[model samples]
Target: MKAMRVKNGLKISVIIMFIFMYGCKQSSYKEFVMADAVEVSESYEIVEEKEMTYKLNSNQTNVPLNLKIIKTASSRYKVKNIVTATRRIKIIAQKHGAYISDLRFQNDLYKKENRFTIKVPQKYFDTVMDSVNTVVDFVEYENITTKDVTEEYIDIETRLKTKLEVKARYETILRKNAKTVEDILLTEDKLRIIQEEIESAQGRLKYLTNKVAFSTIQIDLYEPVEYKAEPETYTKTFWDETKQGFANGWWYIKSFVVVLINLWPLLIIGLVTFFFVRKRLKK
Candidate 1:
């Protein structure tokens, strides 16, 4: 009986040892799995970021396919009649869905001129020019200018996209990793700066888009009048000259009186000096 009891106790000790070992192995495996999951999550995030960046770069590279152009024209010409020509041009602009941005009319001694600044759609630029030609008697000059802004447009769009991505990352950090007030404040400040830059980029893009959409045409229309010659020298009638001479004499007398009044103090002093000298001479 005593041997049997000792054997059973030994058996129980062996069983306990095996259980403890199995528990340790299970714990280690669990820890390893957790570590692997964390590493995988980090890798996935990295891949997603890289993909987004690649897409943005691809879009930027394709900017040259669609060109951004700004067109402007200036025309100076002579017309038969300023008012009639101006009216006809207005009708033409209205027919083509264009508007006069500015109009200036001036009548000089030798000519009448009307200046117009018209804004037309890009598609109607050539049509408007041709229509305006119908009213022109003589074409002094016509200048057309084209500018390419594709590079600048691409640059702004790319920068805006980058800034937006950075802002989103900062926001994520603020929400998840910012544990202290200082960290939160710093993250918010960075986000504010990024937002401002994004808004600036958006505004520049809008202005460029508008400029590309519309074309500007400046028209100067003028009409020449017959020359009127004036006499270089005029001879006044004898009666007119006599009247002018009398008026001049009266003006001189008035001027002399004003001078005497202005020198009253000096005149008084000279009279006193003269009287004193005369008295001394008499004595």
Candidate 2:
């Protein structure tokens, strides 16, 4: 009987410990859920982007993109070198320059507090403010973006590169090669790629040469604002006023109709009851 009592006590102790442990685990889970719920507002601030495309040139346009940069005083540059070294590609970045912008690559992530510029042919407007993007490296992210601008960029560079290279080669062949048909034919195909390249390059060059040849990049490092509500839209448009008025009137009519339809049964029953009561009283 003593042995049995000891066994029962041991079992009771185990049950108590297990219940205590389970309660602790449940409390921990509730705390974790509360923490996650609190963090939701911060999660919404994650970086997001949209792609835009534009036909930036009517004339062959090429713009020379001058990139200026500022970086985290010392550490950022070293981090950028590490990123460039590891990837074997320098993701070219620029400054948001009325004065300056800062770009930092650290924690294996590219962080730009400055502006970025890419010399683009007017024909390749869709390509810029793109290409440099996050692959979601589980540890790092990359981003390159464009600034708000009243102007667009053009592509003239590719054409120039091709033309110059071709021009050099054509002169070389004309001066060096014997007049064999095969040699001439091969040279001609080369010339065709060169010609297309030249034409394309020229098209972009012309556009850049004419459009706003320079752009100012404004760097913003703060959280993006969906509304700038300080000294509001002082010159708010007539169209907006008209649209609001139209929406209010439309809503009022729809609401009135919905209430009428929903109350139809009540209205009909009341009408019947009133008529019956009136007829009986008169009789």
Candidate 3:
């Protein structure tokens, strides 16, 4: 009975230790979660908060985030005059320190359209959009979009750091123990591959940074023809209308004379029938 009591006590101690360790783990995990919940800028919000919450409760350590915000504006307008609007758009781009990246004009039976793609500094994105809106007569469609690329930027930066570290390690190995020619060549090849990977990551990071810095705007201007009613002619006097009626009667008479001249044989047959009917009536 003593042996059994000792065994039970030992089992209890094990259970208590396990509970203590689990409690400590839970505390640490909560702290980590709290630390990661940093406040974001007004222009941004946590895009993957749900995913992060799921990961924190699970065995996952890596958190997915969308942190970088890229802004784009697009506007399509149906203006009374496209030429003036196109000129105004160009001026707006220049005034807002933006550049026209693409300009296209299409003239078809349906409509005349002027398309422009402009690159503007991120700080002036709103100002440029407002300027375009002010110049347009009426807006057909307008859209502003924001995309978060924080996760991508972070991933590329992490890969770059890892590749650089790997390259340094390969360099150190080459310098320390590369005695044989084959060993040296192999180490150099590894270093080259790592260096290439580092460069690729760096280039991608730079591209994402530029995209975040600058905003793109696309404007489509169209001019639709407005319908107009035909002008009404002034009313003529009664004498003028009577003269016109006389002219019309004369025209009708000329047309009848031409028809009779062309059908002389038919006219002769009709006259003979009329005479025969009159003579039969007299008899």
Q: Which prediction has the highest lDDT against the true structure?
A: 1
Q: What digit string (tens of lDDT, one per residue) describes model 3 on residues 198-257?
A: 888888888888888889999899987645555688788999999999999999999999
Please give the lDDT score at residue 205 for candidate 2.
56
Q: Candidate 2's residue-wise lDDT over 4-76, tens digit each?
A: 9999999999999999999999999999999998788566554221111223452335653452221111111
TM-score of 3: 0.55
**Best candidate according to TM-score:** 1
lDDT of 1 by residue, 1-283 (tens): 9999999999999999999999999999999999999999999999999999999998888755488999999999999898999999999998888899989889877999999899988889999999999888999999999999999999999999999999999999999999999999999999999999999999999999988888999999999999777789989999999999999999999999999999999999999999999999999
Worst 10 residues of 2 by lDDT: 69-78
Greater TM-score among 2 and 3 belongs to 3
Question: Which structure is stronger by TM-score: 1 or 2?
Answer: 1
In model 2, the runs with Cα more than 4 Å from the true position are: 1-159, 214-283
What range of 10 consecutive residues in model 3 has the weakest lDDT sum? Answer: 38-47
Candidate 1 overall lDDT versus native: 0.95
| lDDT of all predictions | 0.95, 0.50, 0.86
Worst 10 residues of 1 by lDDT: 58-67
